[model samples]
Target: MENLPKKVRSKKLNTRVDLTAMVSVSFLLIIFFMVVGELSKPKIMDLSLPHNDDGRISCGPMREGENRSITVILDKNNRLIYYMGLLDSPIIAPKEIQYGKEGIRKELLSRKQNILGYSSRNLKPENIIVIIKPSKKSNFKNLVDILDEMAIAKIETYAIVPEFTPEEYKLLALK
Candidate 1:
């Protein structure tokens, strides 16, 4: 009595890894870096400071011919020492100009057409007033190229007075 034959067992298979295409490729690389970080931003330039009620920091009294008022200064190498009114008495004598587009954009478009032709013969409406004076051997791209020539000479009255008096530092130390 000898009859032994019964043996058959083979089954082992378990391998599952399907993270939905790697979680949709990491959420599409975090929405493509948040839309390229908001389209690479950077473009600013809008300064407007000057408000002292009782501090007494006035920039007044310089009116006359065409209600005169210029005074540009920005000296040192790229020199552009303009003049017309007030710097403690400067009704024209600082002239030195130089810096692009036919130098200071043709002297700020001929002083904004001579202060808009003397404010249109006194009816007034274009009181051109620009006093930038950036000394300390001027730099910072000559105060951003004179504030981009006061916005390409459309100047709606300007004033960035950062101190320079002492007769404009002895007229920029006699140039």
Candidate 2:
């Protein structure tokens, strides 16, 4: 055995792995995905539905429009018909108003001003009440647009009335 060349022994390699870089890389990947997920999340609006925990609705008694209420009817073909107060007696007759600054926005602003002046003059505790009624032909976008208008108008009291009365059906039929 001594005559034979001494077998060269291979250097023992370290068995321990430096997990710091690997752990750091894994944490970076996790944080990157989390940030991307949050950024890609879809934005949405909140809708209020009238109902109770027991599955019973409590919308309260309907008010016979006292000229302080406005009913906005959303129909197909992007048609918006609005009137102040009940159909039987309206402060402002139902008319087709546009969407932008020259349309619904103008109407809402003017009407709000009128209501404020009238209430102040009469010394009545009243504010503009908006009732949104979306017909069957109307789309979700129409409802959303109206809701956005309501917000832009800074309307404090508004309700989405899903049900349409007989008079409303007739009015829509005429559209």
Candidate 3:
């Protein structure tokens, strides 16, 4: 028995895991996450701010016809009140319009066409200016809707005026 050669055996490994599949799966998961992150971006609106002191001054007092201005007032309960020209003596009476495609959008399109027609006939074309006023009772959604309408109507000039005059309050109260 001592003369017999001793047999040597190889030790077996406890774990035999193939890391190739796991590495490929991890790479695929990373790629999927990266692609999803790039595809889910928020849409943002571009806004322009007014200059502090632009050295540009009016040559003369604004002509009554040249001032194609409209004021849009957003009140509570989804009510919209708009008037043409100055609030002191609006060319058109304070009219009430609802919020949506059929209401405010239609009104804006009609007004824009009217202004465009007048502008084309005049020697100098004047783009319409819209003044947006949101009351305390109005919510953020209303403000956002008005801004979206401005964009949809292709309105280039607009301003947000926070103050509401006594007359405007009375007008809103009437509705």
Candidate 4:
């Protein structure tokens, strides 16, 4: 018998995979994480706070007709501890520290009002200087909170003791 023409044998099988659903799920997960991520916090350290051009150790002398400055300190626990250099005693303690924006705002407002009443002085809150002293162990979140409070209080100049890098120290030493 004559050999019939042999048909070509097909040995390879083709498989297709659709990645559209996977890509959509990945996109959704990325969006979810982005929205849920923690907010950035400010940096806090124990370095000596900055001084004014004058040789004053702390807040400078208030300008004429100016209200006293508000000096707040943050302890290791990130609490709102404070000492008003002008006041005879401490106004706020570590335990009094609260995390809410409104809470801080209220504290600042009350302090401003109280200061105005003292010494028969009619001082505007804007004239007060808010000094922030955040400890090294304190979290950056706490620093940011205090800064926000100061801004809300409408204080123009604020002071922070920034930790100097090695290079900065060298430069300062030279000068």
State the C-alpha lDDT per candidate. Answer: 0.73, 0.79, 0.80, 0.60
After superposing all C-alphas onto the true structure, candidate 3 shows an RMSD in angstroms of: 8.8
- Of 2 and 4, the candidate ranking higher by lDDT: 2
Write the residue-wise lDDT of candidate 3 on 46-118 in tens digits.
8633222454544544454434778999998888999887677666777888888998888877787777554
Give all TM-scores, in the order shown: 0.30, 0.58, 0.59, 0.45
TM-score ranking of the models: 3, 2, 4, 1
Instruction: Please list the residue runs of candidate 1 whose C-alpha ends up more than 4 Å from where it truly belongs after superposition.
Output: 1-8, 33-71, 74-175
lDDT of 2: 0.79
Q: In candidate 1, what are the lDDT values of residues 59-123, reduced to their tens digit?
A: 65424442557878887777888887665566556678787789877877776676655442342
lDDT of 2 by residue, 1-175 (tens): 6699888999999899889999999999999999999999999998744455577755765343355788899899999999987688776777887777788878888887777554422323236788999988899998998888888888878899989989888888886
After superposing candidate 4 on the true structure, give the runs of residues whose Cα lies further than 4 Å from its correct spot.
1-67, 86-95, 119-121, 162-175
lDDT of 3 at 66: 35
lDDT of 4 at 82: 50
Number of the predicted model whose TM-score against the real structure is largest? 3
Candidate 1: C-alpha lDDT: 0.73
Q: For candidate 3, give the lDDT of residue 96.
A: 88
* Model 3 stretches astray by more than 4 angstroms: 1-61, 116-126
